[model samples]
Target: MFKNIAKDEMNLQDKPMSRFVNFNEWIFEIKTIRAIRVSDYGQPYSAMANINIHGESAFVDSLMTKSEQEFARIDAKVISEFLRQLGIEQVQFERFKNNQPRLHSVSLASEPHKEHKAKLVSVG
Candidate 1:
């Protein structure tokens, strides 16, 4: 929620490297959840409880633990909301030739979610 907004604001600041690193950590945490679910399912369920930080000197590692399908769904929703807040009207995802998901388009304007004649753009 506001955490992503704060991260976005940080990205707009002068120290963008650190902010970008943080943002990438967030993305990795999110995408990893999906990958883990897609990998296995018959393991013990776990969750991301409150991250308790002791002080500024505390060791903070960006490690993604095993997550359940429900956690992955929540992360997906959070990412979608964050993208919406960033003025992205639509995000088109397509499967590659190997059936892997990839980001196809990020449209600022809303487009019909269907196969249209004008949508065909030669990549070559």
Candidate 2:
């Protein structure tokens, strides 16, 4: 499962598969799957799902990050099994797995900022 983080969103290919599954008493509609490259070495794959609980959305990923070390190996069978356990059909999961995981680079332009001088005040 994915945890809330402040990071860039992965870019995926067009026409990704969409499926619905029930999890934790909420209906989740998985919208897209993307193979993310957060670091310069490894690739992180994630599923973007929309929860029907008050129209909330969240991401789900199978990742192991500890002490600045991260690794993940997600394949079709694994994804299929996960979705299968989540009440999604085999066919739908297979389709989701078969969908090409397009990896793209995401970049943001840096905005220039002015330097401000700070005054030191002693608190007694």
Candidate 3:
């Protein structure tokens, strides 16, 4: 019965803004990925993303809605199959599905994710 808090604040209970977190909290570090679903009219993207940090695991529903490329990469089968390529088997799939999984790692200032990506990209 958290009625005193704003609705947006209430949403934070289940979905946190991961820049701040506990030691047990998980932050996905997707090194490289192909794709589970490409951009199709309304769809942004979905990938069988594998986390190769802290612990090794594959997530079936890494819904990355960023326009990382001119077109989305849709050349993957399943999360496990993708992880198998990296010799990372015997891990469980979290199946963390969302239209914007990157939101989990956004800053407290509410900076746009694209701005964060811009810094990592070379313009030369």
TM-score of each: 0.23, 0.21, 0.26
lDDT (10s digit) by residue, model 1, range 42-122? 765343322212211111122144542334334433333333433334544332335554434445235322222211112
* Cα-based lDDT at residue 111, candidate 1: 30
lDDT of each: 0.30, 0.31, 0.32
Weakest 10 consecutive residues of candidate 1 by summed lDDT: 51-60
Provide the lDDT at 49 for model 1: 24
Error of 3 at 49 (Å): 4.6
C-alpha RMSD (angstroms) for model 2: 20.4
Q: Where in model 1 is the C-alpha error above 4 Å?
A: 1-71, 93-124
User: Which pairs clash in the backbone of model 2?
Assistant: none
Arrange candidates, best lDDT first: 3, 2, 1
Q: Which scores greater on lDDT, model 2 or model 3?
A: 3
For candidate 3, report its TM-score: 0.26
Best candidate, TM-score? 3
Q: What's the lDDT for residue 68 in model 1? A: 29
